[model samples]
Target: MDQAAAGMQGAHRAPVCYRHPDRETGVRCTRCERPICPECMVSASVGFQCPACVRGGSDTGPAPAASRPRTIAGGTVTADPRLLTKVLIGVNLAVFLAQLAVGSSLTDRFELIGQAQFSLFSPVQGVAEGQYYRLLTAMFLHSPTNYTHILFNMLSLWWIGGPLEAALGRARYLALYFVSGLAGSALTYMVADPRLPSLGASGAIFGLFGATGVLMRRLNYDLRPLVALLVINLIITFTPGFNISWEAHIGGLVAGVAVGYAMVHAPRERRTVIQYGACAVVLAVVVVLTLVRTAQLT
Candidate 1:
């Protein structure tokens, strides 16, 4: 009897996730009571529930529309989490290819500049000349002569963007990306020499880095890896020979962290309002900075 009891006790082990059999998880679906890994879990009104329960309806019947599943940022959960990231990458690549085929034509017109003419005959152009579209267009461009520039930026985007898109969902992720990029542009316009041409996706990538850090913190994940990577990037940004735009990087990171916090930490009862309201506040700041800089340059 004693031996049998000991064997039974030894056999009783913590449950592994039903979907991902290799992953051990203490968390169980509130509806179905099956173990679930983080990837298989869905945010629920009460406790985390397995995706099956979330999709198949509760024991009482289909989950009401009011109780529909949502992402951490209150965005609707998507079937293809990385779709937006892929599209953004595609757009960047297409723009880059156009830059290559068209020589300096595309870049000269679109690259961010405060106020400058590339040559004596070139019509005076830039943000100060009312070409504010440069702020948005510049982010889709890179040094046409440097293949490595776009290569590195695209790789970083894939590495950081896909997971972020999954966590925040398409709408929230898109807003974060564009706002972060714009924040970088606004700061570059404000601080960097307006006459110098500036272009790259590093600012947006750095923004993703900041948001990823915030998201990891929110989920209680180990942050050492992200911190180390960010440290390296910062070093590259500030290193004397790199010629990187520290202003853009800093601006994007700060904006990303701020927006990411609002997305993850907002009250459940008012998540959408708080999340979008935070984005609006950031945009307002960006607008103020742009106007101040334009006034200085013009």
Candidate 2:
């Protein structure tokens, strides 16, 4: 009988507390699985244990879980590190160099290579004349006669694109850029001297400004500097001695603002659908106007 009692005592030994390694524990915390001494333990409805164990117990507990910290306004937050503006600049520079390589003058090569849907070399023109690839080719062409055409456009893009791209993300910003450019081209085709071949990214850059304006307004951000810069550029646009596609600029600006409003200001859940729909609607309108004007000219 004495041997059996000693064996039972050894088998029934209490667990050691993790917090107080040297002390024996009578209960355990359900959440953390740490043992607790009776003095450190809390009176849980189910059993005696540590304060942490009692707090975490599931039996109609009065002590609630700790509250999470809230984000405060003006608090510094990390931004995404992607550099979309630099990538776009690199692409434009690469294309410009390629144009220079193809011909002695960058101007001459750009004239031949730039997107002119109605131009003699255009694949779409060939297709209409019964030939097919000009639809895609038209997107690459830049103005052959004017160096400032691409220079100013690129400068504007460098200025406004970095911040906007960082805010909107790469894919959305790129879509806006391309759509705005296409809108500008469509406007130029409709209203300007079509016989005078035109190419450049100014329309898209202008669109960036428009989008920036809308985003600033929506976010309650100050846009005084941006507005001032835009005004100075506009004055330059109208000045004599420089050939500027004012039509393209205006078209791109309108499209950009519309896109920005839809994408940035609209509710988050519906943003994608609304942004794409807005772009499509604007493009359709521009295309219709261009077709109507073309019909009138012919």
Candidate 3:
């Protein structure tokens, strides 16, 4: 100690705070053992520590947890509002189960057979009647005989619905979904055989794919994966034995892309207004086409 003091006297030097280098300090951090000044000191287990050492943590420590995740009334987590997606999946499952209960009768009634003779379940035999609801209901129906149809559709729903719903929010997402389906049905109603029935959410799912691509492009993300997906699905749809509805896919994809584009291009200042307008335009076109097509379905 005397020798050190003699050396210090010769040079006029002492240990200094690591953080505040201008201030001379006799104290060192307990954790890092770095010299520290009063201003830089933080209370520690054994002794005072430098502020940096406290921030860095010691062998036995990590900073305390930050504030807890927030929740809303009814214990809903406010961080993500994916409620719409869940409701959609639930409804699809419920409808699928109902199909199972009704057996062969379900597909016969709900499948889109555009100008087929109508009953209570499908009450418009001719375009003269307003059985336009058939176009919408057809989206919810799937082949009761082919389990894979509903399986793949629902899986796609669970996979894609969450992200899309989150991006678009509840109302817009629902609009996209129903409109996409209606577009597919509208096209199917016009182009497909009135005798050959079609069913499934593939059309709506295709709409999501198109919407995803447009939104991605707007957000400046890579779109090759989606493009590849579109190609693959189209190939599957057209493959001879697949017996998929290419008409629905085309209609839904077109509608979804249109909606997605408008949503993407909308000005941030009035995004909601423009989005609603875009949806209205898309729906108006689909409805008018349906009316015109139904009128011609003689």
lDDT, candidate 1, at 190: 94
lDDT tens per residue, model 2, 1-298: 9999999997987677664577564457545667753224333333334544444534333444342110011011113413667777777767766766675344432331222354355332221231112222333455544566567667877878966775566667778888887777777766776555456777788889999898667544557988999898788778887676787788888999988778665544565677778878877886686557646654
- lDDT per residue for candidate 1 within 34-128, as digits (tens), equals 88654455677776776567667543444557655566566665567789999999999999999999988789899999996767666659998
On lDDT, who's better, 2 or 3? 3
Ranking by TM-score: 1, 3, 2
Task: Report the lDDT tens digits of candidate 3 across residue range 1-298.
Answer: 9998998796866666675588665667766788765444444434555534544543233433332111100011223556877787788888888988978666665667777565666453522246666787888888777888888888888777766765565667788898899889888888877767788898898999998887666544557977887798888999999889999999999998988777656654566787778888888888888878777865
Score each candidate by Cα lDDT: 0.85, 0.61, 0.71
Please give the TM-score that candidate 3 achieves against the real structure: 0.69
Clashing pairs in 2: 41-49, 42-49, 114-141, 115-138, 115-141, 123-134, 124-134, 126-131, 127-130, 127-131
Worst 10 residues of 3 by lDDT: 67-76
The TM-score obtained by model 1 is 0.87
TM-score of every model versus the real structure: 0.87, 0.62, 0.69
Give the range of the ten consecutive residues with the poorest summed lDDT in model 1: 55-64
Off by over 4 Å in 1: 1-41, 56-67
